[model samples]
Target: KIETIDVTPLNNEQSIQASLKAFAQFNRDPYQDPGTVMRHPGLLFLSEIGEVKQQVEHINALKDELVTRMHTLNARARNTHVKMAWRGVSALQLYRHITAVDYAPRKALFSWEGRTTSISRPHSKEEFIEIILKTKDMCPAHVSPLDWDDILRKEILYIQSVQENGDLVRMKPVAPHPRLLLYKTTDVKATDTIFSNVPTFVKTAPDCTIVELTSFDFSKTTTRRKKRVFIPIVERLNMYFRPFK
Candidate 1:
């Protein structure tokens, strides 16, 4: 890993600016992919005008390994699930993993460790297991429109969360379904085709930090063989990675 960066030095405007500045470091159209939206950090994000005030700690011990995995995606952005929280701070910390070309997902997760409080959005229970299970390789599953009942619930709760918690942190998902687009995607579900609570974090990643990891190719290959695991599919779309790892 290059090094653990303490980006806490940023506040609202600066944080927003940092996001855009970081965009300056990369050049790629994140939206060419059918579902992904071109980010407008310049317009969507606020400009920097403040100093650093709070800082959050790195909880993921394997942060370095995570960075290595990012080598595939180019400069991309995502919503994260993690938060650098304080006893009563209104603003939360967000982690935006980048892949020199695209953003990584799940690599950036949300974690809150403090009091035991919870938020909930009300909606009919969804057939979540069925819908989630339908994503099998090569095999397609059908979902009933009624099945979306709970998804809307989750989204409603997600929004309620942004209001109640006053902060958000999370990573974006790679799934192409519009229902799953929360990051830099133009297709925001029109008027609650599905409603969700405003998630605290961007589920998508702008870039990944894993490429900077020390070389361990033999180990990585072994890892793939042993676990039958592969890099995230989204990585293929990213162009920042070296032609060959």
Candidate 2:
């Protein structure tokens, strides 16, 4: 199973992510436990609405303090550009300003599938992966092949995608890139639905870099369809991979 979302640290939205992290934890028996999800699946800090409004003030202050506390960490990296690959829909490696994130607390209550699901986190990455595998692919009506052994053996890669408009997008920086995997999302997932619907490519072909995605949810509950629609993000994509010298 594959799922993706922008995970950034901003003091105010921690609760929202706490809710997601909770889902990440309760994902195993989400249908069974509504109470645990209410508490937290993992460690989560609590924040009041007024606290959210003051986040910007706190962040600016942290920046000033960091100027001295960690000035010796890695000065050389300031001028160096690191290269990473995006295996979902684009071969282009995004040039991002890498920096430390400031985390915030998760609010107590939120909505999921029209029902309120609380914030909690999985204790370990292994546990997180388990739920991601189960929740991202399976549905009340049908299930995709998220439990295949062959798929598990492949290296897990994270692809970030951005839709510029209706037709264009950018994908890349596939963290933990498979020694090879096409740019298509389905290819990484190795699922039959994406294989049957999306264009095909063997290994990590450049052609697979900028995939023309076709959504495959014509027959699921409205609540279910929504759950599946947002996933497997693409880092970046372009009609042309800018030639660099």
Candidate 3:
């Protein structure tokens, strides 16, 4: 699991000190239990640490090292077919002790028909708490959102009772996975999203040729479809450009 990764192997002492220095500048006061903040439950401090101009150079250097380490890991694992698609700058996230987070299952974002579902979108901590509390009674006719939410909450609480610093968490693509973070101490970590492409296979009917099609869903309606010729594994399509160097 990514969470079990010992970042010590990937980062050097200089980079670690730089990250700690940046955190110190951002969080001047001594660590406090985020649970004490009645206004926000889990979050103590959240911001793009790169915005600190004084430490921007050091931060970027650290980020580059991390990205390079990812590529190194891929190569070491013989996953040369996989390539980094995109990555974002690291954001500093500080959580208080005893902090708990209930991440919505990835599948909840879509429906059984593979369409995006219209679920409650909470923008703030207060709003999120309200939504969770009200989910039990909201009881929409289509699905029971409460059952899964309750189960995930309990499971997270039970499984992840403690998380230390430098631990990384990876979320799988297009799967319904839940995570809970119960910080034993003031938690500080750099978070970023790295999208990667790996070799994949598409299964099709034995006798039928697979064709590619594009469609857009607007106002809950799919617009006109545009069909494209399917390129087989052995054949290369000229339509797409080569991956960037």
Candidate 4:
């Protein structure tokens, strides 16, 4: 039988630090009965006990300093308009960063119909925003808005993405040569959705790489239908990957 505990509320860096401190204190002054210690002379070694207590005291001092620094950081982190998101192997990784709760890892939370493929590695902050703007693809209905706001405000700070067959990357401009992914099928239909609905290539192709399509039907489709859309294939589809090179 498998049991799952929801630790989303309890997970966080500060909480984990507190737990460690408590564990250290327990080890330093272990609760063994006096009678038991008397029976086993080796258990009551004064020098060893003193050393453990000294180490525990040192840890406590460090923790006190850490608390002060954390308070200062918390103060500075307030009212920040900029936000970031990370794409990793699982949402648990993202959640852990957000909440600081220690729990068993779960499957990727940002998925559709329990089916997911080809995680995105956007090339810039705008690209990341665009990815999240796709309400149908990424939004979690079960999570409360307040919880999400807190998570976004506190936990997420950098945008990490996956690209080129799971190579860990971020949405930032890099020097040398830029890398990107393209659509596998040149025959992308007008009816197809962006990113999620359409299939993308695993490898990054060249710039201005146009995919010539045969006669396509666009009649009957009125709203949100583009007569002609230029999908960037060689580089990132966002401003960062725009053909300025």
List, residue by residue over 122-237, the lDDT tens digit for candidate 4.
Answer: 35544454443443233358877766665444322333332233222222221111111223344342221222111111122222243222121223222333232223332332
Cα lDDT tens digits for candidate 3, 1-245: 11121112113465445444534332323453321121111111223322333344554566566556666664435233232232221112222112112221111111111122121221333333333444455545775677656744653343243222222111111211112222222234312111111101111113322121112223343323324222111111111111112
How much lDDT does each candidate structure score?
Answer: 0.26, 0.27, 0.27, 0.28
With candidate 3 superimposed using the best TM-score fit, by how many Å does residue 45's alpha carbon deviate from the native?
A: 14
RMSD in angstroms, candidate 4? 27.4
Could you tell me how far off, in angstroms, the CA of residue 53 lies in candidate 1 after the best superposition? 32
State, as a TM-score between 0 and 1, how close model 4 is to the true structure.
0.17
Error of 1 at 217 (Å): 3.7
Question: How would you encode candidate 2's per-residue C-alpha lDDT over 72-118 as one tens digit per residue?
Answer: 54534422321122112111111111111123211111111211112
Task: Give lDDT tens digits, candidate 1, residues 1-245.
Answer: 11121113344576566565543332224434432222221112112212111111132223445444443444232112112222221111111222221222323221111112121222211322222334333232474555555544454443343322121221122311111222333333321121111112222344511111122222222111222222221121110111111
Ranking by lDDT: 4, 3, 2, 1
Could you tell me every candidate's TM-score relative to the true structure? 0.17, 0.17, 0.18, 0.17
* Candidate 1: residue 242 lDDT (0-100): 13
Cα shift from native, residue 190, model 1 (Å):
49
What is the lDDT for 113 in model 4?
Answer: 15
